[model samples]
Target: MLRRLVLTAAASVAALSAAPVAAHADTAADLGARAGDRLTVTVTDAGEGQDGTFDLECRPTGGSHPDPAGACATLDQVPWGKDPFAPVAPDAMCTMQYGGPATAHITGTWHGRHVDASFKRTDGCEISRWDSLVPVLPTTAGA
Candidate 1:
């Protein structure tokens, strides 16, 4: 009986471990609403000097712009020597993180694509906010 119970428990654990994890992605409407919102997101880590650019573009979807009123916020010229693992709060304008004495947090958003950037602070791991974007071209209300 003990052997059977142990085998059952082991089988259950194995089944659970073999289960596939589900992942979710954001949509265009969500991204449009986030326009102009401030976020602190990690761009990329090239393992060199901190230098990168975040480009925001609006590609017509379904024969029209997605968000016509909001302009996609452009965040370029990001330079960093090391990763900033901190939870930088997001706003409706820019991606601004607090002072060096920063705290860590895991925060990300779901827009068309899940664009989340995280860091590793000495205290803990951190996540940047989703940058706001002001759509240069917006979609028509009817179209």
Candidate 2:
């Protein structure tokens, strides 16, 4: 009876180990789907024909943003451990150059976390931060 019980326990363990584990696997697509990533981008004082509020939905990628696909792709390029919306360190040195009057606010959920970030072009660091978001904020390439 002990031998039979041991064999049964071993068989159970084997069956459990053999079961598919894909259900619990957290792939990028799976995480995005579960995260419900969405954002509302508001731009102000940018320039003529540049100020507006837009909606952005990623993963499935749909929204009122002009370049939803590009925006989503750009956002996806941010590394896993980095925060795309992170602000420049206060102690960091930055150029005094002004990019423009452009300013933006992005608010929503990303990667299952809340995001409330602001962008501006008042200085070099701030401009770079704003530009990094590219189409997510709005193209300021030539302007």
Q: Which candidate tops lDDT?
A: 2
TM-scores of the models, in the order given: 0.19, 0.76
Please provide, for model 2 over 1-143, each residue's C-alpha lDDT reduced to its tens digit, 9 standing for 90 to 100.
99999999999998887665644555655686535789999998877777899999987889898889999999999888798999999998999998877889999988877899999888889988888898898866335
Instruction: State the weakest 10-residue window (summed lDDT) of model 1.
Output: 134-143
Tell me which residue pairs clash in candidate 2: none
Tell me model 1's lDDT, rounded to 2 decimals: 0.32
Q: Kindly list the per-residue Cα lDDT of model 1 for residues 34-88, writing each as its tens digit.
A: 4433333222332233223333333322112233224322222223332222244
The Cα RMSD of model 1 versus the native structure comes to 15.6
Candidate 2: residue 19 Cα off by (Å): 17
How good is model 2 by TM-score?
A: 0.76
Cα-based lDDT for every prediction? 0.32, 0.85
